[model samples]
Target chain A: MIEGAVWRKWVFFYIPLAAFVFLLLFPFYWMIITAVRPDAELYRPWNAPNYAPFWTANPTLEHIRYLLEETLFSTWMLNTMIIALVSTLISLVCGVFAGYALARLNFPFAGGLGTGIFVTYLVPQTLLFIPLSDIVRNFRLGDTPWALILTYPTFLIPFCTWLMMGYFKAIPKELEECARIDGASRFKAMLYIILPIAVPGILSAGIFAFTLSWNEFIYALVFLSSPEQKTVPVGVTSELIRGDVFFWGPLMAGALLGSIPVALVYSFFVEHYVAGLTGSVKG
Target chain B: MAQVVIRNLNKKFDEVHAVKDVNLDIRDKEFMVFVGPSGCGKTTTLRMIAGLESVTSGQILIGERVVNDLPPMDRDIAMVFQNYALYPHMSVYDNMAFGLKMRKFDREEIRRRVHEAADILGIRDYLHRKPRQLSGGQRQRVALGRAIVRHPQVFLFDEPLSNLDAKLRVQMRVELKKLHERLGTTAVYVTHDQVEAMTLGDRVVVMRDGVVQQVGEPLELYNRPANLFVAGFLGSPAMNFSRVRVAAANGGLRIENEGLRLAVPPPLAGRVGRYVGRELTFGIRPEDLRIATEADPRDLSFEAVVEVVERLGSETLLDLSVGADTMVAAVEPDAPARVRGRLRLAVNPERMHFFDPATETAV
Candidate 1:
């Protein structure tokens, strides 16, 4: 809130915030409106005597029904869910260990190695997919769920490892030392003390990995080919949109439905996510 | 219980020598305190004894067994950290039991030990609550309970009472001393406060710059300090020092400075006669000086102007200026003294200390 007159507050804070929120949310509103609006109203010309772009006079669930019945949207959802979960789990295990080692252990080249791993994440996926596709073919894993599930971790692990490394460093070193002196092996101390205190960090890392794998398109497109095995992002765009004709209602319908799971996850762990970002451990 | 022995202990971090060659034989069931300013390597030495920190060279022994190669888990020690380091997420009961659980104690024994430690700490009612829910004093009890439940051979404390308020610190300091007596564990405590060192330690080791300056009973260190640093470090307002030259005059050794002159007592005549014509640091605690009467010997008295008067209920501390030097004297609260008032103060010749100006070693 800007302190001063009401108009000053509006000019400095509230009005700009309103414009920003409207700009960010208009696309989502458009998606929902297009998904439920009747095709008759949706295709109405802009020059019509009565034209309203933001709202529809009549709304129906026909596009959702078409999305479920006519296409393999349900199968895409299932495939995406399995891939994202398995990849998140795989990344988390590897990330937690790598992050702990980089954060706690005294080893040669640890600093350089951490930076090197993060550098791999900076390489654009657009360029890496070409080589990755060749490997997927070499392993004969193309056109299967394994194609994306295993490939998703290539980017996810580095991202998760970096996030967890910073989180583990914020914790006081005395906690582990005290546990060790109390007759716990180093491994047991980490399991009982460090890992439990790091729940927020782990949860946030898991959520971020889930979202990244869920929205990932290039690797999904490059690897899977079968319609039923395809992920949500790929199947929705490639199968529904034919050569030159865009299925506006069903397209918007798929977009809106495809993003719900990520939103639900974010809201579910919103409190822990903020804690992880702030790295506040009260003692 | 076990005695800890460190021989030629040294620790080096990159280019910095954090702990130098040090040797200490901490007796079994003895409450030994290591007191020093920050970066004096007291905590580092304690950590080495606990095996949390690896020794760069030399050896550490718990009992007769050398623990130089053992990990912290095998060292049989428990530590209370400066911040308490309570496990923030667990209930007080679970935090206290974590050590027993890690050591594979039976469930019934773990509960019994936890309850006993909690009873001693007076935190039995708060055992089910989390550390964050408790107040600072309760949280401190939880930290202590966690350490006591282990029943290790030694207890290591690293400035554990420093985080508490002044009043709470004094209260906890007494509780800690009683706890040590009942537990009868050989404990190594570290603190920067001289008062804490004086009250709690059976024997205190004063360290400075990674080296031991003096180690003795608290009163011994106070009454008879080994060096300049120990003399000034162990007192409340600190021992005052003035550079003075020894002169052979009037058939006696006269200690003369910018402020005044006094004859060396016969007990130190042999030591004082050799330092004639050489400058030495003369030290006198504030409590050893008093407002002088006209009948007091002129040789032991000096005319001074009171600069500031600190009326501490039990005593009045007068900051005085003599010639070009400033000195502080603790006098009776009823003494008629005011700022800028000229007065004659008498020095206690028997209590005076002399140190070499170059080496700073007691003469």
Candidate 2:
């Protein structure tokens, strides 16, 4: 691949690839090691005689046990799951409809409206959350899962809509036209033909929306106050550390566990996600 | 079966007038083909008939009912697109049965019709396989199977065989003819291939720039094209034309150019008499020219040097230079003609065509 000599292959290709992989995986390795390290080894001084920061001589599950038993980690996991699933569903339905209309309908200003939706997705959540916090308070939804459930869709819908629109456009319009000629109405054609063809797109969008809401911190921190209502990212950080002190063991353990579901979702639908991104419909 | 009649059909896409004031009467059970170059409104007319496109101004009648306002589903018709448009996710059986299922047909009836159509198209072995699993020819058959299962009163095909390989295209064209004969359905097909138009159509409509140039039975249009476009578009080698001035010689009208001078045949002499002393286009197909023999009259013969000789197995084509004009002649393969050598060529007077240069219309 590097063209000629073995040294050239190592220098130009394999060495760079190895360095990139090491850089990417280093943080995950640190998190896993910290989550399993005993308290004695974790707090060891850097210059101490037997100190090894990268490896541990005695690995234990005490941090994970403490995270599970001492704090409301499981409650945060459940809350994140519910909020993410509901918001993703809400976003997906609206997104699929908006995407279909924008991509296929002949209405005026469809192009402008599509651009308008994409512009909404570009609005930074840091500023958007300020106004959203006001709305959440006015509706008396603070300190509850509904606050994030409703607000997540503001960004997620636009993301899903733009992605689904591109996917819907990639499918041949003749598939729908032939269906209509074959005695299916426009609605039926979309239901039986277009929707089935767009499953990969919908799955990719759903997974993305789910991951975004699951790891969201800004809105979760601003809106939810109760220990029971906080999602994983917010609760783990807020509960594990006090003003000037840090709980490294339980904090890393909570974070490591918090990311598992999202990782599983990605791995389960990786094939469809790639296919959706490439937008191929073979006939 | 039902007759499809279009009256003053037109389509406008913003500033482009895609189809203009087209009227045609397609009789019942007739395989009518709309043939033309790209953007010539042949597909547009077919789409209007299928109710896929809105008519800018006109009426489309199928079976005595005006289908101008009807959606494609309400009109009883089936279409096979050039790309096959087979549902990639559906199996052959489900794809064929989808239309029947949509119309709420009973399960048994749908199954029976799907099987029968598959049997006709010989795709019975692929009933459980998705469209992507089939070859191009097999996919084409499945597309045809999908249409026939519906048993619609009319069928519309938009260059359905153009996507196949050349050998497969010819094979499918013959099968399509046999299929139409077996079904006896009134069909409207669209294509740009002249050979496909000639071989497959009971009638052919040649169009250009969104206007119908000529429409008749295939051979009829070939023998009697109304204009220069139709004459040139319908034939493979294309009719050759040379601008020749008419002159009076010995009480008869003669046509002469830089290298050719011949008396007008008696059958066309009356039309040539008025154009004397004016320029007109002399037309002849390649097959209408041959090497001159002793029996041929000297007046109808001309001397030329062969510039190129193409030896096709069945016949040979010679590109000849006659003074300033060049012409191609399809001659017997064994004809003793050599490149750069002189040969006397004669024109078949009966097949000689003349056109008014001003209007480019056949006289």
Candidate 3:
């Protein structure tokens, strides 16, 4: 954006930007190249004559075909989609109401309650999973999607609540008050006026919750032991590697396919997601 | 249209008392304004009447019903907020029609009222557009349109025009008067701007620190303010104050201070004679001070050194040092005055105000 000569633009803007883009995209590029490259090149020694790690001459769909046919990739995809979606929905519903109450309602200990909710989010899945695993077993939800679906919200709700609390706070209180004076009850006012204005905020919360649950790992790893019940992050890593012999091509294929849905979700709600982060509520 | 009455209103927000024992009977079709500085509880009082804020312990009656426990929707009122608060998601038409829609007033009736309000506010062309697309003034009109479309029994404006620029504010002020005249709905407006309160309200309530200082017509409050705060709060350049002692000198009562001494007018001389030797606060408006001319009486004039001369086109304001106190005098624009100049300024004897120093109340 700096207006100047070519070298100034290069020094301040373009070169740094190009370097950043290259660095960020390198992993994805490597993933695609490894997934498509022939297994001979993938497993070839580095000292071989035609060893070109970054480039491949004969690209094939064998890894993708093997991932779909030989492994439970499709079932994992379905499991992840359902678990992520259901948890995101539960988190969003709880988050929106909890956020609105924390932001707008004048109740005793509301401030302390909001802080308490945030502190729960910070308990770290690494440590909390020990206690949660006990809780998961007590109900015997292991090896089923129910284990992940019910547990994902334990973390996702807090995250969505905090994000949505800040977002709801940024909205002007007068919108709801004006709606009330305009002859709508408090609930109606929220539905007709405040919530409509908070659409961007809610979407951003939902998108974040969706993305967080989609990319989640620990809970998916601990629970749901069945091959058909496993989520993508758990299924891809567990099934692809066998006793130190890595299935690099199919693993990369699993990663690439697993990330596509998240990418699509982001692209679809990109505008709202950005607006929600920047806190642009036009009066 | 129904009158709104607030009786024995008191509100305590935990440790802070936001509104004190307040009483006002806003008449049917009356435009009542509550004007004060921030934290003076004018908006709190308005919100209490709007049923947005609960009364800590009091009664608010909109028409004949005591609405202390009624919800805002049940209060049958409309309010215009300072930020406009137009639903950003809805089109202008939908924004205006939302109340009607919530009431289950069918499609055609909602359309009729929305269009009628849009026509009145001159916002028909932007009916399909969103709030963010409109200018500030247009958005203000849309907010007004939204309120008018509801046709509520009462209208509450919580500093609605404060967000507007100066020119647009003046324009809107006039339009609000015209709108009120057209609708004749009871209104309760709150603002920190004294000029707005003076121009717009049929009756203005001046408050300070959660207490109602005075309530009267705008000119009544301007001419005969109840206390020191009201006299100082209403005027443009503010009234000047000087601590002076009243004493019997020669034959009659005279007001004497470090910088000036002037005889009391005969009408107030008997009243002034009672507080002979005690010190009290003296107040005189800047506009009542003039450049002393040849015909000016000697005892009613004083000489001072002018510090700064500000010619504001219509009037000239001189910041002057009198004894140990700084005083501002608003004189005629054509007056020959300069900084560092020794100038004689005359005071209108009839316009002088006196208040007890301890009570700070007019004597």
- In model 1, the runs with Cα more than 4 Å from the true position are A1-4
Candidate 1, residue A100: Cα displacement in angstroms equals: 1.4
Top-lDDT structure, candidate number? 2
Candidate 2 has what TM-score? 0.98
Q: What is the iRMSD in Å for candidate 2?
A: 0.6
Candidate 2 stretches with Cα past 4 Å from truth are A1-4
Model 1 residue B204 CA deviation in Å: 0.4
Which ranking of candidates, highest DockQ first?
Answer: 2, 1, 3
> What does the lDDT read for residue A139 in candidate 3?
98
Instruction: Put down candidate 1 lDDT per residue, A63-101, tens digits, no spaces.
Output: 999999999999999999999999999999999999999
For model 2, residues B268-318, the per-residue Cα lDDT tens digits are 999888898999888888899999999988779888899999999799999
Given candidate 3, what's the lDDT at residue B155?
A: 89
The Cα error of candidate 3 at residue B359, in Å, is 0.7
Q: Model 3: per-residue lDDT, tens digit, B1-363?
A: 998888889999889998999998899999999999999999999989988888998789999999999988888899999999998888999989987887789899999999999999999999999999999999999999988998899989989999999999999999999999999999999999999999999999999989999999999999999999999999899999999899887788888888988888888887667789998788999999998988998889988899999999999999988877788999889889978999998999999998888888888
| DockQ class, candidate 2 | high
What is the per-candidate TM-score for chain B?
A: 0.98, 0.98, 0.98
In candidate 1 the C-alpha lDDT for residue A62 amounts to 99
